[model samples]
Target chain A: MANTEQVKLLGFWASPFARRVEWALKLKGVDYEYIEEDIFNKSSLLMELNPVHKKVPVLVHGRKVIAESFVILEFIDETWKQCPLMPQDPYERAKTRFWAKFAEEKILDGAWIAMCSLGEEKEKAIKLAVEAIEKIEGELKGKHFFGGENIGYLDIAMGWMSYWLPVWEEVGSMKIVNPLQFPATTSWMNKFLDHPVIKENLPPRDKMIIYFQNRSTELASRPHDWFRT
Target chain B: MANTEQVKLLGFWASPFARRVEWALKLKGVDYEYIEEDIFNKSSLLMELNPVHKKVPVLVHGRKVIAESFVILEFIDETWKQCPLMPQDPYERAKTRFWAKFAEEKILDGAWIAMCSLGEEKEKAIKLAVEAIEKIEGELKGKHFFGGENIGYLDIAMGWMSYWLPVWEEVGSMKIVNPLQFPATTSWMNKFLDHPVIKENLPPRDKMIIYFQNRSTELASRPHDWFRT
Candidate 1:
């Protein structure tokens, strides 16, 4: 089965989205070659595969090119039958999808929050992050996973939070998730980190902190003048 | 089965997204109650069904609520079972999904392009609108519909190009689709607009123009003074 299929992953080490594709492929026991992308000088082929978004974690198999991290997640689940990332029941699948989207729209939507924004911009970003995290905490009630009892699709979609977000919060010098406020979620976070498949695949925490700190500095020093070629 | 199950559609009158839901229902011969939304004063139930996005074109059938216009179109086809929207072949299905997603992402991503943007902003918006249209035009290639000969899932998803975008272009004072540049798509536009189901159910074009114009005005006049609100 592996011999006939040519699977390749194009990614950068520091990207949380790239980490998602890596985790899913590993869980599914799919074998593929990894090609690292320079975070700053992204390759031309990467641009070709994803012309519209032109961003990576692009998964290419045989002649098929799939972009958009969320869409790529779905395609992997569909194309590879071995490890089912989503549930069999369509309703549960819908619910899982809803949370995956909620997690994305909430957490990552505020990535710009703690960036170069200062004072009031910084303040609004913090409030938005707090509100988003509070909403997530509410969704975590009575569930070990976003899909009750076991880690599921939403888990893979939100794999970054247990690791990367803490790093970002540290760099920004603002706390988004509080254990006291999100006790259930905090416990769930520990379980997510403890899972065998995820735990083995997790990135080095110290390295991520250094990466984001450098990124924050670069963002802060961006020129005030805007130009288009 | 259709009579036994209650299907209701929640939408806004002037929205192209709402039109997609209407076309899908009519194609499937699934009778549904259409509830119009005041975009400014969205109802509480609409809020509950779509708590995350809090935006409409929601499909409620029996006890299930589906948001995201693309997902709802697929659900309507599956739930009704009278008319099929997606192609049987997986590759063809993937292509259809890609085009549908392309139309949606570009249009939705460019939502803020229409606001308080003049001179360079208008040029930027037109460039964006043209790029989006050209991609859709490129995909038309040798197919009658975005999904080939039959009007299927992707076409319903791209339904906006025929009815809604013209309204938007009129109100925004810009021309998006260049028929001369895209002959295949130009012909499809005529067929799609003339389809009885689409033609009969569309909100009058002049009314939609007025609706969006007023909304645009309201958004423009708001004091974006960055007042630390």
Candidate 2:
């Protein structure tokens, strides 16, 4: 069943948040116009669409606009229920959402700080980031995906591990996601990347490294400015 | 219409996160046993129930346990369909979640810091907190509640403003939510307090002042320890 509704996504190429939404849209086989956003020098359309956060990924479905990636993902799932993102069971759904929140609030922030800082600050960040990774590993519990058999909300929310974590690890010169340590998460990362939709959507690893390396250099000089970006 | 499942809430009396969940239970008229935990000296049950965060406001429904107040609110809304906390429309639900998240990530932390710190740091915290309040005021837009007609998820998430903001203001010696500056928020605050469930749930103002005063004193001495508690 082809969707006739006009769907557009304003996103930056490197944003893990944007990538999560892209994966969801693709998995559901929904066609959308993807607009590349310059996050550093944001577009007027981006500003007009998401005046509150003024950030991507912003989803515009016809006249209605939605900001925040998790919100956008839920909106997409609800609007196009062809491939359900959230579980039907309320308890299971709540568990999925809890981990999704954890990915955003706890995991991403720590990874960002770890990748950006240097010296003792960097060491502290690494410890915190690893602790978060261990928590994710605990959640995995030998499951193929966070959603058991298929990729779901928690899987999409944690999509960053496959692409971004590697770069962050390389840039920070740290190893938080090794198969030796977190076997379940490491395996999940591989499986997540191997998924056709996710595989196709992710940017090249070599390119990501270069981009992150340059970004990391800038962040190292201004470590305290982690929250601004 | 009675719930036969065993429902219990592990919470701290002073925590706003815990309060939000408590209010949701009260509003839903769900019979639940409220267990006040000593957060400073973690209860074994609290640690076991919420091994990841080991934090307050853990909701136990039958055999299932849910942590994080926002997650619990969603769970409660889903489990008990009557007197729904979230909007039925997906867009509206997303908007509610967005603001709820903003309240947690931006508003509460700023308020905590502002009320805790002294001198220059306090001024900066106050600025950030006021900015967040101004944003909420914009969202209010002449509404009685964040949910427009009813006290919904966003309202519950921001319930802290009604109880905690005044205490914080008194401790910080700053006025962020006055009728002159944030008329809409000020009005909403009053309306929130007037709600029977909310009115009944909140702690005594005098006791709150004493608790917050002691907290502020401790935070002032160890400004960097803000995130720990």
Instruction: Calculate DockQ per candidate and list them.
Output: 0.35, 0.82
Which segments of candidate 2 are over 4 A away from where they belong?
A1-3, A227-229, B1-3, B221-229
lDDT measured at residue A56 in model 2 versus the true structure, 0 to 100: 88
Candidate 2 lDDT by residue in tens digits, A135-167: 888889779998889999889998898888888
lDDT of 1 by residue, A1-73 (tens): 4335798888877787887888888888888899887747768888787777667788888888877667777
Runs with alpha carbons beyond 4 Å of true place in candidate 1: A1-3, A221-229, B1-4, B88-94, B108-112, B221-229
**What is the CAPRI rating of model 2's predicted complex?**
high
TM-score of chain A of 1: 0.89
In model 1, residue pairs whose N, Cα or C atoms come closer than 3 Å (at least 3 residues apart or on different chains), thus clashing, are none
Return the clash pairs for model 2, or none. none
Q: Write the per-residue lDDT of candidate 2 for residues B1-229, one digit (tens) a residue.
A: 2247899999888888899999999998889999999888998998899998889889999999999888899999999988898998888888888888887767788888878888898888778878887888888987879887889999999988988888888977877676899888888988999999999998888898898888888778775465322
Consecutive 10-residue window with the lowest summed lDDT within model 2 chain A: A220-229
Query: How accurate locally is residue A116 in candidate 1, as Cα lDDT from 0 to 100?
Result: 43
